[model samples]
Target: MPLRSVIKTQNNQRRSFGRDRSGATAVEFAMVAAPLFMLIFAIVETFVISAAGILLDTAVDDVAREVFTGQIQQADIKEAVFREKICGKVDFLLTCDKLKLDLRTIPAFADIPTDVPMKLKRVDDSSFCFDPGAANAITVLRAYYEWPWTASFLHKLAADTDGNSVMFSIAAFMNEPFGDRLNSNANCS
Candidate 1:
């Protein structure tokens, strides 16, 4: 073929290929992929928050067992010690420094205070309250963690005045007989 004819044929083929609709699906997918991926990631993040909640509850229960059985008291546990133990077991994604705790030992379940003090309420990054009470005492343990909120609705449900979502766990039980039982007042501060 002549050089001029070859060039004309090549240009025509290039124009046809450019007009071809075969790649339209790919273009459409590229356009839609972003929102789809975002939705998927949002779902995964939601599941993660839920799993973290369950894991937080589990960790609290595990630590509260020691407190209920007087093991924590026998070892002379402090607030920092309790926080360290729980934060170590809970989600590493969470900021451990913002973790807050409130523990009070009531004399009897009937004597348990009506007020549920520790909640995902106001933003208080103060110290943890450590009061396991005397032996055989009814211990009320409340743990609060200010979880980072990605979804706005989560903040609406569990978030404090701040934007962070709050996670709470409560456990109450009497101490075991492994330690010496002593009489202590309820409503520990």
Candidate 2:
């Protein structure tokens, strides 16, 4: 073979090898970036939702404690109080207006059917009010939160049209705030 032809053949092979690797990195990056970005976003969203739920649960527990202790008057157990005291703490993630608070008294802990109903009870007093022979009374406080899912994919896969509504409840039995003089109608005086 001629020296010039041999040199040309070598150069052509080198050019073809370089061209083959040039676009490979870009294709690999395109393949990997999309799913990686999606996974990161999903992780962040999960943390946000979990933090919101924890904050709400803590707020409900605190409010229910105040109610049972007679620190908050029965009349104050309205929507306004929930908005100001509970929802106010987690306004960044949840809307106070969308939350529902229900308070009830249960005859026994066993009688409380679900977290939705049990957490709504403001005053349990079952331990203090019940006869020694009778089943202990319990207070249940139910807090229903209508959480709105921000991610479109999460909404489509995990949430309903009304958004992801989660109901959280906290219950405890303690002495009645007013002892024997406790009147169901009267505010804590």
Report, for every candidate in turn, its global Cα lDDT versus the true structure.
0.72, 0.58
What lDDT is reached at residue 153 by model 2? 73
**Candidate 2 per-residue lDDT over residues 59-165, each given as its tens digit:** 87777666566554434344354448777776787776666655555566777546332223222222222111112225566666655666667766743334454
Candidate 1: Cα lDDT at 32: 100
The regions of model 2 sitting more than 4 angstroms off are 1-21, 74-79, 115-137, 159-167, 175-177, 180-189
Residues 120-173 of candidate 1 have per-residue lDDT tens digits of 556453434568777767787877766776765555655344666567777888
Total clashes for model 1 = 0
Estimate the lDDT of model 1.
0.72
Q: How well does candidate 2 score on lDDT at residue 71?
A: 50
* TM-score of every prediction relative to native: 0.69, 0.64
